[model samples]
Target chain A: MSHPNRLNINVENLAIGYKDRVICQNIDLKLASGELCAIVGVNGVGKSTLVRTLGNLQPKMNGEIQIAGENLGAFNMDQLAKILSVVLTEQPASKNLRVQELIALGRQPYTNWIGTLTQEDKRYIQTNLKAFLLEDLKQRKCHELSDGQLQRVLIARAAAQDTPVVLLDEPTTHLDLYHKVQILKMLQQLAHQSKKTIVFTTHEIDLAIQLCDKILILDGKTNPFGTPSDLIKQKHFEQLFPSDMVQFDSSSGSFKVKK
Target chain B: MGSQRSYSFVFAIIVLALLLAFLLNVSSGSVNIPFTAVLSGMFGGHMEVESWNYILWNYRMPKAFSSILVGGGLSLSGLLMQTLFRNPLAGPFVLGISSGASLGAALLLMGTSMITGFTVMPFLNDVSLVIAASLGSFLVLLVVLLVANRIKDTMALLIIGLMFGSITSAIVSVLAYFTTAENLQRFVFWSFGSVGNLSSRQVALMGAIVGLGVLLSIVSIKRLNAFLLGENYAQSLGISLKRSRLTIIIATGILAGGVTAFAGPIAFVGLAVPHLTRQIFDTMEHRILIPAVFLYGAILMLLCDVIAQLPNSANILPINAITSLVGAPVVIWLLVRKRKMLF
Candidate 1:
């Protein structure tokens, strides 16, 4: 498949970690528009730190990140908000907010000082509501939503934000297999239809491999980014985890436990 | 839309209750001013009795206005604190602002006697005590703001505030031990919290400060609503977390510090009125909650002040005692009835 030349994000020699500690270093990647990329790693391999660094939620320890040729550090919060949107794993403080109201918050960058939604804002929200099949849940409070439903609403919120890039931290977490696949499929469709760059971190390597156009494998030794076929050919997943309990089956593109 | 209609209905009822409580508080004081006299006095009409005029204007009017201001200020502060911390149990005093004010007042009232060799100073009136209290609260607020900028976690900020409060309390205790019986008695009385002791000028000052706080809160309604999604999400939405946090802390300081300076750290109204408004209005939007809490707080404080007056008796109870006595039970009833996590 031929990828578009329009780059949404570019990271060069990026170092991300917490406080004085560095988790990953010398990371370089380029993500283009209309791509669905998944960052797959074992638990605590700095997937979140990398995602947050790219989103500018956490300060990068070193290196430069650029969105549309503008340095990430050069964009103010408001400017960055128009370029990128993020969906976090933590629940909102008040689940008492209505679904539509919560989703409308995506228009914060576009709204006036009081955050009144305009006609264009309403259109964006309506499109997401239809796309995510959230019309029935529009009037319901967020606390009343199931985990899968809430995750979908959050994703819809990010879509309504109308940014060029959307980053999600474990979008399929806390979902059963059916719902997980359903959300992944929806994300895949969103990326393809909107021509937006969609990046998410997940532990579901097998599922991500099936749906994502490109995968970034971080195994503390080799950090490679490529199409699924290329990463599999490079044997990136085989070294993802310790070989004692679970082994990566390259042929099946999955991990199997040793008996 | 249904919730909006219910919010309006509840708002109207609360407004009505507030007016009724205001009239009741203005008329039913120890001197028993007639309802007509109170109404006429309020509107600059001729009064039936001149003494009733004095009582209504010089005494009851200031007290009633102070009650409204204190109530609205404290409740709004509490609402801001709860939102900022994302904790339901947070109140205006959760930052130990009131404790700091108490320490300031304790130092003035107790420490002065130790240094000047006099238990009573003729010049040290309510004004000096208010100044001392304001100084103390503002000092603590400055410290908390400084710490808040460095600490990103709300829970950590809260614990720091509590530590500040404990430190001030320790100093106040040390002061109390060395204070004379007469000076200590004066300090104790100031700590009991009274909305009725303010002169008209002090009431005006309180109104100015609290009005500024309320205005700041109104300006921050959008940022506060964004905060409902927690800090990281809010930041992603273009909210400057540091700026919003600073605005909220300063607003809370003005409201809580101003009220504590004058009303002697009246409790429960700040802590309980926001929860009450949330329960009654059934929405967490700050746009709705800000005005609702303001109105409901004024009503509750007026009602508490009326109850504290003891109805036709000269003896008045401490306003703080009545707030807890009345406010705690209502909150308990709400918890029992709702049977869900309010926060």
Candidate 2:
């Protein structure tokens, strides 16, 4: 068990949605340092809304979100950015930006007003580039990258940001199975080695079960969050989807189509 | 390393083109001043032909300078707008700022005569035309800023800007319908766009205002680069979206409004130069693109102005027509070659 003081993110009695409507309420979750947590749900179950609210990209209707024991709303953009970095699913507006340039943007919070990278900043960027195995793609424009390559670059950018907590929304949306597993494994390694709290929302329940330290399940009735084995023992995956389409096999800890 | 070499090479070519175009603009007017006379006049040396000295200093110098300012200012504004809206097709005029200027100029040239029954107000002359245009553009800018605060969707804001443009154009058309033939002709000529009409004092004023806009752009380079990743990503990166958006709007208003006030809504430079710069330089970094676009825009405008002068002929083409004629083909070629949206 982790010490209570090591909690990186703590949400209590939260309700999240857009513009006067509430999607889910009575939500409580605590993420500790070095934990890789995955939020899994069926489509339209407010996984994105929940993730966005945590990232402070959307307004939370009613709740308390604490980052490092400080109120999430209290920190300004700059303060919040120092502690939390996010990688979103949206395509970049300009695909003509080079890979190195895109990665350098991670140093924006540390850069001067004119955005000139310092020697220390350049060193961090270079380290992240090597860590992510992106040395060969540094000169390539973002538009020239494959989906898996771009995903790695984005993750590398987040790593370069060097925040304690990193949030991602569907980081593996458009990749093949092998690439998807590769990205998840890389993220897991990042969380464990760097002692950063990595939280992301994904539809890959099987992969999340295999790799993530903990899982948050949003299934319309109740949002249950726990370790993958604990959630499986609690029959969380069985109620994830309608029985007509898929069935959870407790023995294999995976889901299968109903015949 | 290869990219750095290419960037320097492209910068050199653009600088060479700008200098050549500047010389061509100064020396190839109706009374062709020889290159030596233009050069001597520029350097403050004695000129053999007295009138050549007068023509180069008093007339062609201001015109050429205004062209450079207009070109640099308008293209930079366009680049800012494209980044702000995240739409490749967005130009400085997409916000209806120039149309608002047109409305103000139309009201002065035609509306006053109809309302007061005076053929022309002595005060409502060339200087006043610029003032009216500036006032009009700033008014539109304020309204757009107000709208921008309420709307988060850039596409929605773009549509609202178009609607504002439509409303202003409709009012201008009504004014045009009621005015006399002489007043209508004056309004039409103003709309035709000329870089050579302003005196040196007016050019200085335009330059000062556009310089402030350029300064704002330089200050906003970090925000602009963050914005290329889309608004949400930018926000998550700890960027204050509201502040960045407002800064971009004000900077664009100053650059586009200042140029339109003096240059009569010169088209295509704002709409096409950034695209051309991106194609030539092959990168989207604002730090590189801003200076590169400024130089390319100055060169393009000077080249267009030289062509419009028709060298040694008294009859000159309207600058608006020349820009479109040159700019439209480049845009078409870009479209045909890419066969897909660059954005």
Candidate 3:
């Protein structure tokens, strides 16, 4: 396992935007190694877009991102892939691909042009497969799995990617209450054991406040960055949701609609 | 059977089928010849008639081998197109390669007749048509590739390809209208697609083109698999999408154009065989799928040739007609079963 003191990610004055429209701006943040961060916001906010930009999946509008003191663009694809991995929200309909095959794709950066898995690659895959409890479903197609199981499969894939930083878009979107907690716990466990920076976005803010070490809340007007306790202490959780329909009870630290 | 044994079993079946098709093709012809005589003649032993020996070696052997090459080539091209476009409906004909070849052949036949008349132009043979067809097919493929880059939608590219096909067909029709009766007869016959029409030289030519295309496809397996997740995903995996697509488009053009140039536009085999191969193998991996399609295509085409040689039937079935008969049903079955595109 890598040490928290060694792994570092820095985002300086980052502005994430789509074509002809700016989503978020002037975002400066740092993720130390072994941090389990949760990005939370109301619907239509730019949480997912921000995560995607920081992961280097999309181009940032105006600023620089660095991983371990090296500029993002300085590293080639394989070098960058070794540092950061992303689990996209879109569920692929590649039903013909088995669970093992799908996970093996995460090791594609390390494989040769023919896409053969090496012994080290096989070891990585095997470790993740057992970690996610996907051993029995190794031969099963992705389409055959439940949504909860599929989400775990995706996480296992990211683990097999063997990067220091993992960015997931809404990892618990399809899971039930039990699986959601399980996945969040698994992510926290991954961060602690592997010393990887695990960041994910979710609508489950109350649960996030308990599980996540840090919190990034994109309010579409003012983006706030800090741990959950820091945000709660700063008293910024109340203004996040819509003012009329939703009200944040400061004492309970949960949102409720006006009667 | 074990998985490894199952793979070998399939390979053996393909080999046995190839040999059977080869032998049956030699025996069943206009004049019946015994299998024993055909074998004996090939082995330098005494055979029944001199004419039979000549027909077996010169005519049937070339035609059968040519069909094998073209069938395997076109189906492999179809498999590549289906993967490239991510649309099951996409094949060689969808990209207007066939139409381009037809227009090229038409121009040579009708244009030559217009200037020199049929009597003086009698010396010009299938060689001119083959060259013209290959050039036209390559040109259309280049145009389609350029357009494909500008357009993001797969269906839009397919529609554009169909429009190209229509445009070339219209040009051939105009040539047909202007040409004299004798040249028109030659042009029409050329369009109907027969395995028997290929001479030894044309067979050699088709063999070279198909061989090159198949070899290129084999080397492209890694790139092609990346493409299965879509172009953006493929590009992220260190593949230059433009370069990979160019290789695929050129390979497809060679297969479709070379076959159309010599054998005419033999339809349906390209469109149907890839999907059938996928269903049988139950794997989308190109390493397995590409070769599976080639064998599946050869067997299907050979079966169609056998059906084309119906007994007591005054008129022999055109190769296209036989392909359509087998192809149309398979396509319809695919449509009903899958509902969406296979890829």
- Alpha carbon lDDT of each predicted model: 0.84, 0.85, 0.79
CAPRI band for model 2: medium
Residue-wise lDDT of candidate 1 within B12-84, one digit each (tens)?
7888998999999898878877788789889999998888888888899899999999999999998988887
Candidates' DockQ values?
Answer: 0.52, 0.54, 0.26
Cα lDDT, model 1, residue B322: 94
- Global fold similarity of model 2 (TM-score): 0.93
Which has the better DockQ: candidate 2, or candidate 3?
Answer: 2
B1-343 in candidate 2: lDDT tens per residue?
0133347777888898888899888888989778888888899999998888888888999999999999999999889888877767667676777888888888888998999898766777656776777778777877876776577676787798789889988998899899898999988887889999778988898989889989999999989999888888788778898888888887887788778877887877887899888878777778888999998899889889999999989999999999999888977887788774464
Q: Give the DockQ-based CAPRI class for model 1.
A: medium
RMSD in Å for model 1: 3.2
Ordered by DockQ, highest first, the candidates read: 2, 1, 3
CAPRI-style docking class of model 3 based on DockQ: acceptable
Tens-place lDDT per residue, model 3, B76-126, is 988887877667777777777788888778878787676665533656666
Error of 3 at B41 (Å): 3.7
Give the true-contact fraction for every prediction, in order. Answer: 0.53, 0.62, 0.14
Ten residues in a row with the worst lDDT in model 2 chain B? B1-10
Q: Model 2 segments beyond 4 Å from truth?
A: A1-5, B1-6, B112-131, B138-167, B180-183, B341-343
The native-contact fraction of candidate 1 is: 0.53
TM-score of each model, paired residue for residue = 0.92, 0.93, 0.87
